[model samples]
Target chain A: MKLIPYLVYLLLIAMHEVIWRDVTAIHGVTINLAAFLVLAVALYKSELTVVWFGFFAGLILAAGMPDRLGWHALALSAVAFTAFHVRERINLKSPFAKFLLMLGGLFLHNVLVVLINQSGGFLYLVWHSALTGAVYTSILTLLFFAFKDGYVTVRKIRDIF
Target chain B: MTWISRLFSRHSRNLHLVAILLLSAVLIYGNNDLNRYVNRTTLFFSWPFSQVRCSIEELSGVNAENQRLQQSLVEASLRLTELDEIRRENRRLRSILEFEPEPGYSLLPARVVKVVGDKIPVSAVVINRGQEDSVLVNQTVINQEGLVGRISEVWPGGAEVQLLTHMANRVAVRVAESQEMGVVKYIASRGMILENFPIQGNIRQGDLILSSGLGGVYPARLVVGTVASVEKPEEEAFCKVLLTPAVSFSSLQEVFILRPD
Candidate 1:
């Protein structure tokens, strides 16, 4: 509903890009920015804002990464929609809930991406990727929590007025 | 208001599902198109941020490199003196052997100023040398260690040296031991592959591969690289030989553009 959260979203995206610029593993793991954006939108739960942010976030992710178009858009929109539903019913104001939801979304998004890309039954590769994705996403989710509270408090205050 | 609500709202859950499905459709469509314009536009927007990050990284890299370079320069200066003495002795021995030195083999020392452009398989290194400095197209370029590549395009103040590892380059090379001639073609997915050579001729690992004088582009006996592997698969048309290039492209700082005789 407010401009502050949108600005916060942009800042978060930039921070993610800068932080996860380098690939650490041989197979490599992406930071899943699109998934993060989806979670952020769900955390806020304004449908129009979520859709617009998700679309733009999809565009950003698609542009920076050489992956085929629409993949990120599909994934982000799916996650965002799911998150938005959860946000509507549950008290998702807690950082722990946000982290768990994001962790699950990241797991689903990466597995789906890997499955779509892999034509052959490369089980070992897929397994390794999933494991790496889990570990990396957990760490990123923890870092996301470390920064979440301050932004949430500020937004809550703005919303109360 | 009721009509608008009915048309637009439905059940929120169903609406959400439809939105996701629509997004998925859009995403699949976008990927299928694979439009270069979208990708480039994205890159353009993000370039400034990427540049800032690159500059910061480069600044730190340059500082560490400056210290190491200073130390290396001292060691290299001493090595140069020793090398001069060895070269003089070698020249004397060559004179005794009646080995006439090839004319027009003047080495012009140049420094790499920038990497102007890069594609998947092609990259051009812009050197400080130009036509003003007698740098011409097809001039054999080499570092102190071994062959780098030839000057591809010569500008008035700068020239582009197409590294030997570039996909477009192919050098006619001869095996130093067996004297077997082969064309060294740069394959994109793979490194330099020696193609269209004599099948009977055997090439072992560590065999010295050099530029053959047949091409008239690069001078003969310039060290290209050592053969890393020799794969002779039966029923295949040509031997699948891989060569590790002598010069490292990413680390190139200084090079000499040798005038082809």
Candidate 2:
């Protein structure tokens, strides 16, 4: 609910956008860090918070990219909304479920981006780029979740002291 | 019953989602007006990252530079032999006809700042130079090896170059040895393909390919690539030619913008 966390998320997204191209690109496929972040927030945060996070994160990414401005915002918001609804209906406590959610979110994001851009060879693009990117982002999401959990545990121990 | 309380009611979340989506749709519709400003702002924010990218490139470029230098040395030796043959031919041709060679063009040096759209096969790269340096859209970009790409968009302090490897790019090129002309295009995973050349034409492996200046987009005779392989399919009217680009896109760092006087 605090504005500070939202601003911090935006800042992290901005920094990720700047460096991810160089650090994460492999064989022309890159991890969609923004999408992963959106999914992570959706899984952990309140519905309203996740929705706003998705929109703002998408906005930050769209601003930096050359694609049509709203594509990312729309995609992220939709994915976040879906993830939030899914979270309400099901238990997403399992790592496998979280990974699947991450992949689905990234895939939906990529599909929206391609469609909005009206890029030619839609099927080929989805198969080659979207799927690969989803897998890469999902792998990254797993690592991020592990790190976050470890950090949370460490904080809890420190609080007890 | 206050307006503020109503705005924060249960439906407020849906309202926020709809509002954000609507705003995004509006922005998308009116993107042209905001694109330049957004790109400039992004460029400003990405400056530090660009510096870091340059530093990393510098650190890693040493081995690549050494390999390139060694390769160039071998090429120089071969060129020396070719130059002697060309000199004799030039003398013979000059005696037969009065002609003048084309004047050399000056190059505006620029450093690459970022590569965009890495997830897709087609992507553009951002360069440090911009309109301030007289860099214009569609201007030819090259490095020491050969043609890199053409300027696609130019902002005040930066420009985006659509690399020849981009699927949308179609280059008018000619075989240097035989003067056979064709259009070179990128075919996703297949690299550069020179199409529309007659199967019977003198296209062959190792023949130099250069920009023919037919489309008026690029200058005449800029080195594009070499005929990597020539395939004459029995079913097709034209030859299937692959090119090994003169410039290695992966190792691209410094490039020159050819601004014809």
Query: Which number leads on DockQ?
Result: 2
Give the TM-scores of the predictions, in the order they appear: 0.44, 0.47
* Model 2 chain B: worst 10 consecutive residues (lDDT sum): B93-102
Residue B22 of model 1, lDDT score: 72
| Model 1, span A16-35: residue lDDT tens | 56544453333566566656
Fnat of all models, as shown: 0.39, 0.42
* Candidate 1 structure quality by residue, lDDT tens digits, B114-184: 87566544456999989999788988888755788889999899999998877778889998888898989
Candidate 1 residue spans exceeding 4 A from truth: A23-30, A64-67, A88-98, A116-122, A143-161, B1-27, B30-34, B56-72, B80-261
Model 1 chain B, poorest ten-residue lDDT window? Answer: B92-101
Off by over 4 Å in 2: A3-8, A64-67, A147-161, B4-10, B34-45, B54-261
DockQ, cand. 2: 0.23
Q: Considering only N, C-alpha and C atoms within 3 Å, which residue pairs clash in candidate 2? A: none
Instruction: Return the top candidate by lDDT.
Output: 2
Residue-level lDDT of model 2, residues B4-28, one tens digit each, is 7877796787787788877777766
